[model samples]
Target: MSTKRQLAQQLGVVVGFDDPQAALEQYRTPPAVASHLIHLADLNDDLDGRTVVDLGCGTGMLALGGALRGATRVIGVDIDPGPLETARENRRRVGTKTAVSWLRADATQVPLCPDEPVTAVMNPPFGAQTGNEHADRAFLGTAADIADVSYSIHNEGSVDFVEAFAEDNDGTVTAAYQSSFDLPRQFEFHDADSRTIDIELFRIEWA
Candidate 1:
């Protein structure tokens, strides 16, 4: 029941680097987009009283948003230590009492508690950068391995790929939402101030 503005307020207060390593694929998820994805997952009745994992969580947008949205527990996992530091700071700033845990580890390698039904939400790399192809596949495959339901983001062009990937991993795409993903020029790769890419939020449920 949180408003987008309210969610943004909670996430926008935190700060992060505009661009980080391409291997990490660390584009900060926009506040509105993070809110929308989390909202959609909540609408699907997938979050309340559940342990929510924010894989590749950058700056804690999805983690903090899920905490704010009444999740029973929230774990923000990332391979990079920098963003995980930022996530800790953001967690302290938000002051959410939802049993939040920040773990610095690869999303595909993170350990899950046994007998706990987990749900994952992430805005992973779209695999556009050099040497980073099929990055989203790892995240989706890991979610399929450990999560009951997952909400993930991908480029519009990868719609067919995502669907097939989900099906192949014992999950089904129950829903997909399209939105304009704003990409600010962060890296030194000659570009404009910002650009918008068509992105899709896919809701995948384990079969």
Candidate 2:
């Protein structure tokens, strides 16, 4: 089994969006964070021989991570075709034998119905932008519809919302960990050249 650090190194080649849309909160998920979450999911025996789907999969960091580890198949869904193109380039950059598919569709509305066990990995928008509050709820709803289990990254102090949503949807919060998102000044609104935001990772089992 590849350690987290090794997985990070493997995912280091993933490229970020060429032109990020502030409305979408598009950003490259840090290799370290992606590696840690994927590694944690692997530890839970959630990935191997399973269909792993990455929602809002900017440049395919998490999706590619799953492929590198031992997932039988990986599908990355995103609304932007630009990032999907970059994700295709990234697949070749991080050479692997596992099958991977990139679909240009909204994460919240992707038409996917996998027949095998499914695991979702997503770094969705935190709804920091105007008119987008509670954006993660749509993603969670889609996850509940598609995946058997999911690992998601969210803004800090999301436990109550996650837990309540889980309960309402016949799911359970199986595990949680504190993590950080290393963000860069890719958009005009960013005040600093770089910032590290404290975040939380949750593992939920959907029924």
Candidate 3:
């Protein structure tokens, strides 16, 4: 059996969100985003023994990557159960020695440990939904609330959006990187006709 298939079997059945295939179809992480995350984590000297959170952690790619990079503990959080199940299965398949945990919860209302500092990485929804502006704002607001320092992914065109987020929370963008990604057919709203989508990865710190 393929590794992914074997993982699905070992994880039993997922509830809430659709099965693995559906989840993959609708919510796969873009390769550029993944690469940027890994690069940012590698550049940070504090990641070796720190706790990190992967918000909107579809399939745990970021979380697993963090573990491989020597984080003391990596937590993957998502609202949907299917993605959580897939993340757990991926964790098992990779078989890393670093600690990894998956939590099924809304990203906007993450329950965090009060005493420990956390570094978070997230690729939040980019307000592409026709009428879901509020959802996207809430997601960003929650991200700022939960971490000491954060690296967030957003569309390159969202300069105003990012600036507003930083302004609202007394944070500043310490660094930014650009990544280009292909839009998957499942997310047709992205509407790239053979063109790569430009995305920005911003390192944010509160003032």
TM-scores of the models, in the given order?
Answer: 0.95, 0.98, 0.80
User: Could you give me the TM-score of model 2 versus the true structure?
Assistant: 0.98
For model 3, the superposed segments whose C-alpha errors exceed 4 Å read 1-26, 187-195
Best by lDDT: 2
State which candidate has the highest TM-score: 2
The 10-residue segment with the lowest total lDDT in model 3: 8-17
Q: Is candidate 2 or candidate 3 better by TM-score?
A: 2
Writing each residue's lDDT as its tens digit, candidate 3 over 145-164 gives: 87767777777776677777
The local distance difference test score of each candidate is 0.85, 0.94, 0.67
For candidate 1, write residues 42-132 as lDDT tens digits.
8878889798999999888898889988899999998888888888888889888889989888888778753687889999988888888
Give candidate 3's error at residue 105 in angstroms: 0.7
In model 1, where do residues sit more than 4 Å from their true spots?
A: none
Count residue pairs with overlapping backbones in model 3: 0
True-structure RMSD, every candidate? 1.4, 0.7, 6.4
Q: What is candidate 3's TM-score against the reference?
A: 0.80
